[model samples]
Target: MFGNVFKGRKVLVTGHTGFKGSWLSLWLTALGAEVIGYSAYFPSTPCNFKVCGLDKHVTHVEGDIGNLNMLTNVFKKYKPEIVFHLAAQPIVRESYRNPKLTFDTNIGGTVNILECIRSTTSVKAAVIITSDKCYRNMEWVWGYKENDILGGDDPYSASKGCAEIICNSYIKSFFSDRKNLPRIATARAGNVIGGGDWAVDRIVPDSVRAFSEGKQVVIRNPNATRPWQHVLEPLSGYLWLAAHLLNSPRLHGEAFNFGPDHKVDKSVAELLTDFSAYWSGKAKCKLVNKRDNRKESMLLKLSCDKALNLLDWSATLPFEDTIRFTAEWYTSYYRGKKGMFDYSMAQIKDYTNKALETNNAWARGVFND
Candidate 1:
């Protein structure tokens, strides 16, 4: 389904060793993109990038996104045509522990990437990846629109919100309306669950941690609801946005939310139940009794109509299938299944192709039926 979107293109993906970054790197490589990755070392010991053999495939540079000199050097050397900035302190709980690092990495790193892009001449399209939490989460019932006021409750969320502001500032101060300048867009997506992600404090990885050890997975907020989708779902949207931005400058200077259909909206306990079923494990969690009742948005969803209408993309797999595929991958990997890498690659290819086929089929059916 990637087809020739990335043929012979130099794509720079930050945070390539992280969970989403590892998946994006593999997808870009498969699509024939000459990929250069710049980010800090693997956040954890057993990183997804190492496990998936991604380092061998891409030209990975071990450096900090906060280091502008290193970033500038990489930009001058690689001369990337497209850029995907995903570097950040992604953990919410850890953000509480280390707010300063979160701001430096998330907010400062975003500004650093923009400055690097501004200095470079060859880059054409830039996609800054933010989080759904970037929206001024008001603890309301309605889904977040792109125009919603930006705010954050916790350090991680606030940093992401600040990153969005940085993106907007860069676009306004320099990139916007500048001829021959790169088209820049910011993307916000929901809680993503997928295979090969081993990040701490994340729901899927936490579930994997407990399930693999034959213990009950601890859920921090059992009733908290989030807009959950497979990792590939949002990656598909990001790729679509990147491709669209390459040809459509009208799409620049805008923020788009990529997420699943509303029917797939789920609570933490419901997700754990599905996880237990898919992986054959007992799932249980206690309601947290922490005193720092720094309010967390119980229900945060995004309206992805812009992405659907403009980019011609939608989440193909339902929430059940998303969880099932994720659990299956981890199960197969832990069980020493033959062709684990091959199997995971096959899953990506199969799911991506199927989504494209479904979307095209729906479009064709609109007139034929």
Candidate 2:
């Protein structure tokens, strides 16, 4: 797995208390990495980090990414060999409510992380996780590629675009020298769904809340289409890319998209229909044509050709399996299933086996060769 590059490595994951970040940290611990997690605080109640007991497995540090002094001190003290920057205000609707905080945390926080990486000599590789919304969405049917123009009408999307620009600037100005040892890259992933995500305004969590109470879930945009994949899908890409960046200088400052195949694109309605099948309780939804000032992209997708060709990485789960994985997790949690940490780890193992069966470069341990 990941060419065993992560084994015995010192890895720092910012935003470890978040949904995607907790999963990534758990996976790193399984890979035998000495994991250090830094986050401002738990972003939500019933947080994945607490649910999974990650604080026992990794060194957890609570601090804001906006505070350069604290962030820099962590880098200096830990001297991590690899960094995965996932820290940010990650909700779209929340961005609408607090645009200033969104911009400050997403954009300014990224700059602080980059500054730390630039000054810290112990870091060998870093992967900055940005949202797919970073692409200036034209709302066309075609998927966005790596080189596409970046702009966004919404604050969250715009913040991500600004973060990307800042990363590119830092790469070219500070890390571009051939002698520079720190290799940095950015990853853009589409809508990620899996267990342990309890964020506000997301479909999965909202549905879980409603279905548990035998109530109908509200559908805000039933026709909007998105590229949905399991959380492990993108985490695999991030881990693989970080390992490669350590040795492949040409990959420095590159950006790659991790998403499902275009054929897997589904509307919001279709996803709920499939999700309901695996759920045990009465699953129902009510669609309302409510008008709101917060405009979301009607359609968005990403082309992973670069990830496939350059890094030999691609999303491994089919749509059915992705939904099943998510549904099973939430259902089990609701059923009062104990040992969720072990259960989540089992899912990671299952995902790895599936990837190995498909001959994914990272899962087969072939990338190091």
Best by TM-score: 2
Q: Give Cα distance to truth, residue 353, candidate 2, Å.
A: 0.7
Clashes of 2: 0
lDDT of 2: 0.92
Q: What digit string (tens of lDDT, one per residue) describes model 2 on residues 75-112?
A: 99999999999999998888999999999999999999
Evaluate all candidate structures by whole-model CA lDDT and list the values in order.
0.83, 0.92
Candidate 1 ranges beyond 4 A from true positions: 281-292, 360-369
Candidate achieving the largest lDDT: 2
Tens-place lDDT digits, model 1, residues 169-259: 8899898684556999999996999888888878788878777777766576677888899998888878877776776677888889989
lDDT of 2 at 167: 98
